[model samples]
Every structure is written in structure tokens, then in C-alpha cells.
Target: MPVLTLNADNRKELAAAIADERWVVACLCAAWCGTCGSYRATFEELASRHPDKLFVWIDIEDHADVVGDLDVENFPTLLIQHENLVAFFGTTLPDAGVAHRLITAQTELSAAQLAAQADSSEERRDWQHDCNLRTLLGA
Candidate 1:
């Protein structure tokens, strides 16, 4: 699927995406970021390769109410989730190949492994409560 530009009009769709088994790869960025603008096409191409996943382009400045507290520290930060598990959340290098590898690795894991990671450390545990897009978007 193509990248979904998150906003009020289609939050319901985001909600359904969140509720699915498919991975939610959200690129948390800002409209003014030069790197983000250039990387948009690469992100969309990456999404096409994984049709079952839901890729969201969230301009943090525009949707601050939804992602404000997610502590996005860099442009093109990727928030990856599956079911209730926040598999990964942090700054990602702009290289689409690197993203491909990361997403593949995360998605290849079984559900038990993901749930274990969610409880493996304090930070990981916090991700379930804090950084989950489902919780943030209430979707």
C-alpha cells in the first residue's frame, strides 16, 4: 500500500490499520525538513514492497495532537508496531535499504517474540503504553 498521510479525515482508517496484524510503519517527520521531503518517494516505494503493511506519513508539526508526546527526536523517525507490540521506534537512517532490512527483521519474528520484547526491558515495556500508535491515535 502507498503511504497514508495521516489527518483527521481518515483517522478511522488508521484505527482499522492499527487493529490489524499487519505492521504499522509510521514515519514521524516535519513538513519543513529537507531530508523528509527528499525521502518521501523512497518511503512510498518501500511501502509498495510490503503491501500487507500500513505505512503512514505523519508530519509531526501538523498532527501534534496525535504524536506530540511520542518524543520524536529526528526527521524520518519510524514508529513500527504490530498488534499491541511496539517493535521499533526511533530515528532511522534515510537509506531505504536499511529500512527494508529492519522491517523485514522485525516482521519476521513470531508473536511470542514480539510480546516478549515488549516486556524484556523497562523502555520496551514503556513503548506499549506510550509510543503505540493505537494508543496515541486512539485507533
Candidate 2:
């Protein structure tokens, strides 16, 4: 499936997908970043490969309300979630293979494993509290 760009038009669909507990892979980028522009095609290709997961492209500057106060310090930051548990939230290399591997690795974890890992470290715990898209999107 193609990557869905977050906007007013499809915000409901994205919200519903998150509400349904589907695995969501979101790419957070800024419109003005050259790296983000170049990585857009790669993100799309990653989405095409992961048909089972919902892929969303979010421009932080354009959708500040949706993003809220999430500190996205780098371009192409990714937030991967299943239900309310944020499995991973951080910056990644722009390489498609790196992202592909990350998505695969995260998806392989069972729900219990994911939950355990969510609090396994201070950083991951912060992701659980601060980086939840469901909360950010008000879904």
C-alpha cells in the first residue's frame, strides 16, 4: 500500500487504524529538510513492502497540532506503534534497508514482549509516555 500523508482529509482513517490496534509506522519529517525530501520515495517504497502495516508520513511543521510538543530533533524520525504501546520512537538512517529491518524486528515482538520492552529502559519508557500517536492525534 502507498504511504498515507497525514492531513485533514485522511486524519480520521489514520485515527481509526490506530484505534483498531493495527501496527502503525509513522515517519516524522519537516517539509524544508532536503534529506526528508530525498527520503520520501524511500519511505513510500518501505510502505509498499509492508502491506500489513499502516504507514503514515507526517510533516511536523505542517501538522504541529497533530504532532503536539513531541521533540523531533532530526529529520526522518520514526514512531512505530501497536495499540497504545510505542515499540520504537527515534531517528533512523535514511536508508530503506535500515527502516525495513527495524519494522521487521519490531513487528516480530509479541505484545507482552513489546510491553516489557516499553519500560525496559528510561528512553523507551519516555516513548511510551510522550510519543504515543494515539494521544498526539487525540484518537
Candidate 3:
């Protein structure tokens, strides 16, 4: 699947994906970031490889309402979720290989493992409430 850029028209599609419990791999970036612009193609290619997952590109400055209260500290922050659990949320290197590895590792975890890991750390537990795209987007 191609990367879905979050916008007013397609917000519901992303919302539905989250509500339906699909594994959503979202890249939160800003329009003005040069790294984000250059990395878009790489992100798209990553999407193509994982057709089972929903890939979303969220331009933070454009969708402040949807991304409210979530401070993205850097460009190309990746948010990976399955069901209601946020499997991983953090800034990643622009390298597609690194992303591929990370996605592979996270997606390989069973639901129970994911849930346990989500609660394993303060930051990760906080991600469950703070960084969920479903909650943030009001899905």
C-alpha cells in the first residue's frame, strides 16, 4: 500500500484503520523539514514492502488539531501501533534498512508480548496513553 498522507478528506480512513485494529506505521513529520522531504520516498518504499500494515504520513504543522499535545521532538518520528497498543514511538534514523529492522522486530512480537513491553517502561507506558494515534486523532 502507498503511504497515506493525513488530511481532512482522509482523516476518517486513518481513524477507521486504528479503530479496526490494524497495525499502523505512521511517520510524523513537518513540511519544512528537509530530512522529511528527502525521506518521503524511502518511507513510501517501506510501505510497499509491508502491504499488510497501514502507512500514514502526518504533517504535524498541517494537522495540529489531530496531533494535539503530542510534542514531536524531531523530524521523522515513527509511531507504530497494533490494536490499542502503541508498540513503538520514537525518532528513527532516516535509513530505510534501520526502519525495516525496527518494523520487523516490533511486528514479530505477539499481542501479549507487545502489551507486556508497552508496560515494561515508564516511557512506553506513557506512550500507551500519550502517543496513541487513535486517541490523539480522536478515532
RMSD of each: 1.0, 1.1, 0.9
Cα lDDT of all candidates, in order?
0.89, 0.91, 0.90
Q: Clash number for every model?
A: 0, 0, 0
Regarding TM-score, does 1 or 2 come out ahead? 1
Candidates' TM-scores? 0.95, 0.95, 0.96
Local accuracy of candidate 3 as per-residue lDDT tens digits, 1-139: 7898999898887787778756899999999999999999999999999999999999988999987678689878999999789999989999999999999999999989998999999999999999888888778
> How good is model 3 by TM-score?
0.96
Candidate 1 residue lDDT tens string, 38-128: 8899899999988989999999999988877888888789988998899998899999999999999999989999998789999888888
Model 3, clash count? Answer: 0
In model 2, state the lDDT of residue 56. Answer: 90
Q: If ranked by lDDT, best first, what sequence of candidates would result?
A: 2, 3, 1
Stretches of candidate 2 off by over 4 Å are: none
Candidate 3 regions with alpha-carbon error over 4 angstroms: none
Candidate 2, residue 43: Cα displacement in angstroms equals: 0.6
Q: What lDDT score goes with residue 118 in model 3? A: 97
